[model samples]
Target: MPSQYRPQLLGWIDDLDKGTNYLSGADDRLLYANDNYCAFLRKTSSDQIFYLCISFICIIGSLFLIPSLIYSLPSCNNKAIYFLLLAGLVCSILILYVMIPELYQNLFTRKGCPIIFNRKTNKVYINESY
Candidate 1:
């Protein structure tokens, strides 16, 4: 028999419109609560600064390395090895550029919290970088 799920690449995701499973975050995730409404943060409890910092460092390092590699290439002792090293750096940089579109927003411009819920309206509003 075929599986009920419409399986997709990378992740197995459910149809958002359907309430598929018994899922809820902990009370500690709550920001505030009252008679009218409540708000909660959906971000993971674990710190993500390290990952973001690493990506940021990669961006900075690539920017600096590419120029210096080019500048020193002509003066290097072994042209063949210099060209090979430059090719490696360029390929790595190309990979980084492909990843930039998503990473840039997360690294620099992600201002809003991950998610928000309102009991009064019985609705969820999401304004997340990811």
Candidate 2:
């Protein structure tokens, strides 16, 4: 029967309240929302848009490389070209499957965990339960 933890419970509640206050009334939320909006608008704020643009460029570049690889097939050695084509195809597929989805989720998804930022304490907390 070691369930008599009143003091611990009170402390936990206090911490929770403080965290809630910080998250609900901080500049960090506005910053996050602003950054997200800028990303959506394809505007410049930080390096996030640049990184995404670079990914897009890579995807397009890989697509173009495929055709170049095909065009050079007649003069190129069979085994080396085949391996290069295979590797390029695999990389393109991975970029489409893994990287794109993750980027989309990070930039778009807003229904899952609520990220809490405490500017007072400079702490960030994620509430995954809600």
Candidate 3:
């Protein structure tokens, strides 16, 4: 039979004696109480900042371009404005979708299968049974 494997949480240390996992940092914070590796694969502060910045730019561009497009509707023959308008609306919608906390959590947090430690075997396994 083929061996089964589970994904081990990276950058963490487990203590069977203490019955707790330690997360890396200056203070070495304790892992949160969860069977699943909640501490793994989190977005960094820099990533959050970048996402916010890009989202802001997209939103601002949409706000400006949309109004301009609406105001210029009398010139329906100008396909360029309509194209710009469509682009702006699409960008804004995409930004909003990305910013949605529920959607982000569902997509990034819940959907991933990560590696975790098998304490009994003293070996690591990739959690493919997600």
Candidate ranking (TM-score, best to worst): 1, 2, 3
lDDT of 3: 0.47
lDDT (tens digit, per residue) of candidate 2 on 45-104: 333455566666766776776577566656666887778877776776666566565445
Worst 10 residues of 1 by lDDT: 6-15
The better candidate by TM-score, 1 or 3, is: 1
Clashing pairs in 2: none
- Superposed Cα deviation of residue 90, candidate 2 (Å): 1.6
TM-score of each: 0.46, 0.40, 0.40
Q: Candidate 2 — worst ten consecutive residues by lDDT sum?
A: 35-44
Candidate 3's displacement at residue 21, Å, is 23
Residues 16-71, candidate 1, lDDT per residue (tens digit)?
32466422434434555455444454443332455566667777777887787788
Best by TM-score: 1
Model 1 clash pairs are none
